[model samples]
Target: MRRRTYLAGGASVLAGIAVSGLVSRPPSNERLLEAAREPSGTGEGSSNTETILSGTDHETSLYELDAPNDGPTAMVFGGVHGDERNGIEAAREISDWHPDAGTLVVVPETNRVAVENDDRRGVDGNLNRQFPADRGPQSELAAGIWDAVESYQPDVVLDLHRSLGIYGLHQEFVGQAIFHSPDAHGERLADRLNEDAVPWYLPFHRFTPGESTLSGPLLFQHAARELGASAYIFETTEFLLDHSTMVEMSRLAAAHVLELHGLLELGGDA
Candidate 1:
């Protein structure tokens, strides 16, 4: 079927816009704990079940929706930046979401500190850059986040992020998409997402080489180095305050992913 035909209905809604990320002040130790354990887990543990996925007193939530069978495993990340609500919303859609094959390990809010403060930067004002699994975090708090992601070991990672809106465009960048150079795995992942079509700003999304930044595909691509994990960074534009737009954008992204996995039938209700 034609690509657009493939994306007809809700999936095509992904073709709506573009978005982007980081910032912050030193977060209190207790606050970090709260941010870590904020979101609920996959099953009926509580509104805070996703919190347990982070371990003892961990603040950020990791909502994983899957069974421990065989097949491939996927990691769909949302909310690298707290202000980037679209990614968080998208990951939530994926959490209650289930698929036939493989596994889905989701960390809706990778950076809890930012999520709580509604700030983009981490405690140290640095982006939560230690991804693609290096050592653990230098600080006790961030180290906890690093540990969770490293352990999950998702096969394919989709890091959800958003752009800065108009000012971002003036940078000659309406929207940017991350793909690994010479890495077919990353390229293919990007193809899977673009196939669903999104409300990208430019005529087409900008495909950049993953050699810079401590976040997004750069980190995921780096992590792929050791784990052989295929990672791609997805950037959508952001205005925030527009809660409805955020909700719909996340819904479309989730629907697009469901289409990729052939589980649109499951619906978000899963």
Candidate 2:
């Protein structure tokens, strides 16, 4: 498969700014705790369930953890690129998790074929590029993932991945950062994640539609615009954080987002 060129220019500028640290410095531990201290939400509480979503040639698992309180639904997926080990680990961990409130849907592996093969592109093509299908038919795997996303009608969606290089440091990489759609909800969450402690923290980076046009149809953007769900793409740097650290950071990021959305109670106060 050929590399996409749409994001070439915009990514350069974003990287430059991020490397310069002009945006904001990493927050201190106390500051992080203070900034993180927001009112938590309450939940009705329920058990966890797992469902296997199957398509023509691919099958992935979906875990649903329902809270006693009827709240928003959150969808988190990983392994769309197969080789992104960090996201896959995080997604799998989230699958077994029980949220404090609201509904949590975890798709640990979006591209089962690609993941099994440890390849970026599946047998059909890049699963990430096949989303929100415009003209041609969607790959079987992409279609299956889309069906699950649509059926759940999530209030927010988080797509996790691991980038090859660190953002700002590597011109071609978008790692160690949060790539968000135009939706304000997702953007706000990205901002919050930006303030996290070092190593696990990520800077907020917004890619304009024109910049990402050739990157393929983005499911996150589609979910935000079409389904009215706050969506984001969380990319961790494989260079800076080890696989385990990356997974831990991904979990922290997801928990923060859930808290911000009031989907889960942050502390016992709620």
**Clash totals for all candidate models:** 32, 5
Off by over 4 Å in 1: 1-58, 67-69, 132-136, 165-169, 172-174, 180-218, 239-270
Against the true structure, candidate 2 has what lDDT? 0.64
**Candidate 2 lDDT over residue span 112-227, tens digit each:** 88899999888988777666634533766666677788889999888888776666656788776676655435555545545452422233332111112223477776676567
Q: Pick the candidate with the highest lDDT.
A: 2
Best by TM-score: 2
Please give the TM-score that candidate 2 achieves against the real structure. 0.73
TM-score of each: 0.61, 0.73
lDDT of 1: 0.50
Q: Which ten residues in a row have the lowest lDDT in candidate 1?
A: 20-29
Q: After superposition, how far is residue 235 of candidate 2 from its true place, in Å?
A: 0.6
- lDDT (0 to 1) per candidate: 0.50, 0.64
